[model samples]
Target: MSGRETGATAYLLREPAAGDVEGFAELHVRVWREAYRGLMADEVVDALSVETFRPIWSSIARAHAEGAVVDDGRAMLVAVLGEEPVGFVMVGPARDEDAPAPRQVWSLNVAPEHQGSGVAQRLLDEAFGDGPGYLWVAQRNSRAIRFYERNGFALDGTQAQDRHDGVTELRMVRPD
Candidate 1:
């Protein structure tokens, strides 16, 4: 695969395979730790075990391996560099009762090493696309907030505290 806009190494952007469940768990934990370390409590960030996330990813990727139809608009795209997943994005229907949009970017992350290499942008495009949606990002994650803003998101003045860790998250919306 050719580079979309950045990144020297080529990567393939596609839906996750069943075999990718473990990789997703591992990368998700690693990226979460890197991105949330200083923003959240050390114990909270370090407590995100890969074992806990594996079952969740397994369920998400199960249908892909079973050849099931993906009728729901939900999508989870993975950016794979060779045999490893370097980035990923998960988008689906908004979860909030008073959501700004029907679609939401549930999660998006790129390995710290691939942050500015455009892997995150590519994953965002493949999974969420250019649309009127929303996402909740950590208030202290300046880098991620900037990236989301560059991708057309604007702070909507709404905020929430994570139930698990109690970190405040700001809601950003992309309007139609």
Candidate 2:
């Protein structure tokens, strides 16, 4: 789906292609640095590098292209404006043993310039579909928490520290 956003031509959300790996990696690092700036340590944010994630994104794209990801309901959707990727979402079956829902939103991000342009909403709708699901968000990311709440997710009182960086995260669930 696509439309004009603000004044720019809006983005189109579609399954990621192998050629999109580099773009996805770059966007992932950019969004994480911006979104987690004040909520996480500078060192941690600075450590985010596209080179560090390119291989992983490439593997996922390869799996997706080979039709090996659908059985697990895993997918990576990219939102492209013109020829550049402005955002992406990764989702799949929940990994937590105690999760209330079977699906989990592993990541959802939009370029700061694209915020409030319905890109995130479209991504969420496509990722979660019409089913119960959950996601973990940084506890201090009030903007994201509010966005999830507005989209039908509510905090389920579950919290944990990210193993790699020790940042606290809270679980939110949408049971519909």
Candidate 3:
């Protein structure tokens, strides 16, 4: 495991309820700051706020409950401990114009404390599954890249600058 593992504990996986937005948003900021410490400018990462993501999570939850997940290969699941989300995974139709696969892993994040407790893998499997897909990982994000590799993704000589943070990202694809 790339991140530290405390002994495993009981955790729940489920669809994100509207009430989970605050916790999920906080988790998003925490995971990004922890995971991208050296890879992104501190100011850029620090500027991220839970307020910015609350509506995003709310909309996602509402969409899911409305049965909007039937098409587009979209799915998301959160790993929770009590009322807080320890980790989450989101997948959907690939957004790139020349995407390698129809499916894309939009995001997979776990709090630093929960990193190696298998919560990440559980969320990933519950959302992304074994189907063909692709994802972009920051070039120097070795831990995430390795995890993706272990799950059957491999670099495909493609690169792009992240629109938000300007980080270089490499494309990895899992073929059908």
- How do the residues 1-176 of candidate 1 rate in per-residue lDDT, one tens digit apiece? 23454546788888778899999899999999999998889998978998979998898788777767366788878888878889888898989999999999999988898889888888888777898999999999999999999999999999899988889999999999
Q: What do the candidate models score in CA lDDT, each in turn?
A: 0.87, 0.86, 0.84
Span of ten consecutive residues with least summed lDDT in model 2: 1-10
Q: Estimate the TM-score for candidate 1.
A: 0.92
Question: Which candidate, 2 or 3, would have the higher TM-score against the true structure?
Answer: 2
lDDT, candidate 3, 27-124, per-residue tens: 88888888888788888888888987888988988876787766757878887776667988889898989999999999998989877787888778
Q: Please give the distance, in angstroms, between residue 68's alpha carbon in candidate 2 and its true position after superposition.
A: 2.2
Q: In every candidate, how many clashes are there?
A: 0, 0, 0
Candidate RMSDs in order: 1.9, 2.0, 4.0
Worst 10 residues of 1 by lDDT: 1-10
List of clashing residue pairs for candidate 1: none
